[model samples]
Target: MDSGFDLVSGGTDNHLSLVDLRKANVTGKDLEKKLDEVNITVNKNTIPGDPQSPFVTSGIRVGTPAATTRGFVEEDMKVIGGLIWETATAFDTKAGEIRAKVAELCAKYPLYE
Candidate 1:
């Protein structure tokens, strides 16, 4: 919500949120793949009145349960939201930097211990 991206249905009440990628000038598939490359997992989803096929959707579904379980808090999530925006807005140019930042963030809350 704090990110500049447009929330498909506006404020989410759960761990999941659907992001409309039209304004970001990127496809759901594109963002999903880019995020995956940086170790952030998200799924391509079709938004209302979607023009693209389900395989190449116009939206993405992001969930926070895993991050929450890993001990990420509100500030961490806000940082993540900013990272998502940066990734969407500058997919090619910011990959390496974003990846490094993601690794740093994840390292703070190791999954194993």
Candidate 2:
């Protein structure tokens, strides 16, 4: 929300957040690929009234369980949210910087330590 993205169903009461990508002028397919290129994993999803097909959705589902298991705190999530916004808005220009930040976070909490 703070990152200028809309949440489908208003907001989440649990660990998942469904981000509508219409306002960002990108498709869930595009953003998912971009995020993946930068090492961020997310799933494409369809929002209520989505005009796009399920395979090329207008939204992406973000979840916290994996990050939480890796020891990501709220502050780290804020940075990640900012990174997601950057990836969605200026991916071509900020991909390197975004990847670096992601590496820093992953290094901070090793996945299999």
Candidate 3:
């Protein structure tokens, strides 16, 4: 593993995995904002190597396999990507609408029976 990347224990079985951002040039806050605009949902995580408190993190990780399994195709991915990008660029103004849209999309393709 690289100095910045920490592998998830047992690997990830879900559509997404959390990645530490200390290695990357971006911050969790910035990445979160960007991902939100494109409809990509991700969680902020703490860098394992950090000496600071873990409660607040400096990394954001995102994935879309779950949505894909739920019937999201390339077009959906594009839409999601756009939303994420937008959110990253302009978070405060677009967060609510983007969240609502994400909900609507999720409703269209439920995860379970």
Candidate 4:
């Protein structure tokens, strides 16, 4: 993958991205929990060749449709991606910062007028 992300099926041709995190030594459930803690919604996924249970998957599924629906654009998605990465790698230390950023983004792109 471009940024060295461990992607499933090698790459993506759609809106959704399936990230294999086995080599990272992290579980999808933990990653999802970390993302959720900072308001970055994501779902656990079963990547090809995954050897873990669904409840403790080795991958995560991330998409930007909901954010786009809330008025987010390409740049915002990039920012959110960075925040997600930070939170995934260092949840406790980056929670406040990521949450604040997510709040700012959501406010700028509110669901309703």
On residues 12-113, what C-alpha lDDT tens digit does candidate 4 reach at each position? Answer: 788898998776577999989988888889999988878999889989998878987887887887787677667767777879988999899899987878
Clash list (residue pairs), candidate 4: none
Taking every candidate in turn, the Cα RMSD to the unseen true structure, in Å, is 1.0, 1.0, 6.5, 1.8
Model 3, residue 71: C-alpha shift (Å) = 1.1
Output the lDDT of residue 104, model 4: 92
Clashes of each: 0, 0, 15, 0
Question: The CA-based lDDT of model 2 is what?
Answer: 0.93
lDDT of 4 at 38: 86
Q: Model 2, range 1-113, lDDT digits (tens) per residue?
A: 78889889888899999999998899999999999999999999999999999999999999999899999998998888889889999999999999999999999999876
What TM-score does candidate 2 reach? 0.95
Candidate 2 wrongly placed segments (more than 4 Å): none
Cα lDDT tens digits for candidate 1, 37-103: 8788999999999999999999999999999999999899999988888899986899999999999
**Model 1 weakest lDDT span, ten residues long:** 2-11
Tens-place lDDT digits, model 3, residues 14-62 = 6665655554455676676566554566876665565435555665566
Candidate 2 residue-wise lDDT at 48: 92
Best by lDDT: 2
